[model samples]
Target: MAATLTRPKLDVKSLDPYTFLAVIGKRVIHPGGRRSTEELFSLAALQAGQKALDVGCGVATTAIQMARRFRVAVTAVDISPLMLERARSNVRRAGLERDIEVEQGDILGLRFPDGRFDRVIAEAVTMFVDRQRAARELVRVCRPGGMVLATEFFWRQPPTDEAREIFLGQVCPGMQLDQLDGWVRIYQDAGLSAIEVRSGPFEMMTPRGFLQDEGLVNAFACMVRGLSHAAYVRKMAWLMPRISRAVPYLGYILVRGVKPAAR
Candidate 1:
């Protein structure tokens, strides 16, 4: 649940996607969450029979959770075919193949018609896309007055000196960090209105381990397996300092916005 202070320069282009997903497995990020499934369901607030579209839905865990929890029809889309396949497998394993549909598609250009979805949600996926374009696509497909629930990595205050150096010096050569204001701009620029922003501390959801625990290392390793060995090592080193700093309250900006009823 904690925000990653600095990520290694892992390119993720070297490994097979399926193998990569297998490495990370179901323990990606926080598993099960600190709160019970009931509490997590409460946070989603999904209504029965509502049509849900998860943009960049990774491996379909959230989509399956939404269907099982709220009795909704969930359509999960990812640009990568391999990811879609993995998500499909998860849906079947959850016995939600009928409830959740896994599709291969791009976030910037959704294949669905306008007003096709009652809700559009994404988790930790928006950061990788063109925020403005992705926002427009999400809003465009959602029915008027429907909601868009998304979580993005954002900084409240700019990173401290040490954090900045780690990102620029050791992590990706020119990776830019997003602050709260920057995120708001993305939503605004994409024409979304009535946005609400919420922030919380990223504590260990389970009784035991925190995000900085070995869990993140394994998750990160799988995530960057596509990169060359040299890139992976360099990025891992940069993360050492931030993990040591161990900033608490590292979490995403939980944002909700609405599409105007009329065009």
Candidate 2:
């Protein structure tokens, strides 16, 4: 196995919310955390010897799980160099390097050929970019009759102006969220059939959720790392209050659909 990449030093002040969380050892970064991931897995019905693509694969957590638990081969991709490095490391640590390939990839323009994968998945990804274009790419790469799945943040109810500003304006600028129906429409417009959706309140950062997603040991490790440096501590201090402001109105939408088989 390749020597584990040295942990890269990051500028805590400038890092995005997800990257910052990853830097501090948070394993589950999506809006609905592990709960939505379980939903995605149940929808996938993965089988051995199948090929899967995990776009925006943060630290390869889900990729590792899919490979180990379902015995599928996973090509995991992310746009961030930092995330990719972490993903590679995690894959190696999980002893899944043979089963999971980590690489840099963009959601709007996936590098794979059309109808290349048995399943295509993106978690908490499309909302940050061109949602329609990303959805089209996901559908394009998936084999005819294959499943395409994604998780995205949505407004469970209209947010107060302050809540909206705190999340969309300050914490995650440029993230485009919509209602659950809008999400279903994006996949439908991309030509997916038999679309299905599961949704829940945003809970990744709630005390119970943090523990649930990271597990007790990992959650404690994350806390230790978060306070290991003054910069990390400061970043956590600045971020938690802002996130709390928006969590009340936010939820996650897990959407899955099948690409129609060739006529």
Candidate 3:
């Protein structure tokens, strides 16, 4: 008799609405777009010979970009195996296998040695994990005097009930979403010094955003996916206006700090 083969079950708990966007081949899932990533990297002041780490690097888009744009070597890590697979594929496609390394990892507790990287970047993540712990980990892995930056979904102000229901409940479940000041506070509490923060709108699902992030071809693919995938299509049907209504209070923040230099 032939034995029955079993495939591993998909980890739905790891998924959020963003996973739907990724499934449809959308690479730029960051809050603002590609420009936002460039801005963050520029602010990080990444340079050649710098060793960087991208924590929770979904699909490794930023990792590849930083390696190519700044001539830096990056170790990209994500908790989700599915994301790591896609990220590895993207890295290979970019011909950046030499410059970028992909690893499966947990953000709350990383395996790298202390003071390992020149730059540590956690983008659009940490909202789901313990912000304080994640920040500490990021700073821990970063060399003293190195830059550590995290970009997360930030409430422009306190969330109204309806907005909370949509953002915290629907958009990002089981997440610890915070307001602008609250996000900044996480780094302060983590003992990072020389903190700098920048805020902007989360117009990521809009047309202009698509162009800015994915460009013409991939944006077209995303549009097609929005039409073809039932779940994504339904998500879009419900998401746009709901987020639009909440736009005034919804946005993202880029918070950067220097790991205090040794005395």
Candidate 4:
């Protein structure tokens, strides 16, 4: 098992929807959920013995999958102490401590050296920060000719004023979302080549998406855990309605690009 870190108590009410979902044992917390993740993996074309970095790793779910499925070495990083603790626990529980490394990291400024990894991925993370810098950092850490991939929320269509307000104003303040073309440009400007894109509706909160992402048993577990406490119940009540209001206008973009090989 990985070494345990100090677990900090999170105030449920104050947590953003993603963290709140993670707290309630929802393993897949990104925009397109498990379906998008599968698209990412397909685009990655991972190979045995490659080095992969998963930024904003949440609870190491994707990292565990990458290592277990592709036999790759994964360094999983998240900024939150609570998230790191949960990631470590999940990695250990999967008996993948040896395969996956869990640690603290930031997206805008990563600590890794240039071209250190063969594959780099960030799921629904760049929207929360300076996306250009974040995209550059993801590209920077990938070896020349290596792949960098990210999943992000985008406007599927023009959102209504009320829908936009409910999401960007209340549910996810400070989150920056754009249309599919805008997202493509961010990575293109970051110096990636041979870019590819796949997209789907944002369904992380929908009943079908929840079941698909978590599966039947885990979905049931998450619901039970969510309802087990008053605070959890209140948070869900506050969150679901707002999320529903915006879901109609939201979608996810999975963008893949390759760092240009040395000239």
The model with the greatest lDDT is: 2
Q: What lDDT would candidate 2 get against the real structure?
A: 0.94
Q: Deviation in angstroms for 34 in model 3? A: 2.2
For residues 1-263, what per-residue lDDT tens digits would candidate 4 score against the true structure?
Answer: 12211222457789989888888899999998999999999999999999999999999899999999999999999999989999999999999989999999999888999999999999999999999999999999999999999999999999999999999999999999999999999999999989999999999899999999999999999998788777788889999999999999999999999999999
Candidate 1, 1-263: lDDT as tens digits = 12232343334335332223333453333222222223334545789999999887767767877899789999999887667777888888899888998888888889999989988876656666677788788888989877776666555556677755654444323333477778777777766688876655434222244343336665455545524354444543444354444333234566677777885
lDDT of 1 at 238: 46
lDDT of candidate model 1 versus the reference: 0.63
Per model, how many backbone clashes are there? Answer: 8, 0, 0, 0
Worst 10 residues of 1 by lDDT: 30-39
- CA shift at 4, candidate 1, in angstroms? 30
TM-scores, all candidates, are: 0.71, 0.96, 0.91, 0.96
Better of 3 and 4 by TM-score: 4
Model 3, span 44-86: residue lDDT tens: 9988999999998988999998999899999999998778999
RMSD of each: 7.5, 3.6, 4.3, 4.1
Can you list the residue pairs that collide in candidate 4? none
Each prediction's whole-model lDDT (CA) = 0.63, 0.94, 0.83, 0.93
Minimum summed lDDT over a 10-residue window in model 3 is located at 1-10
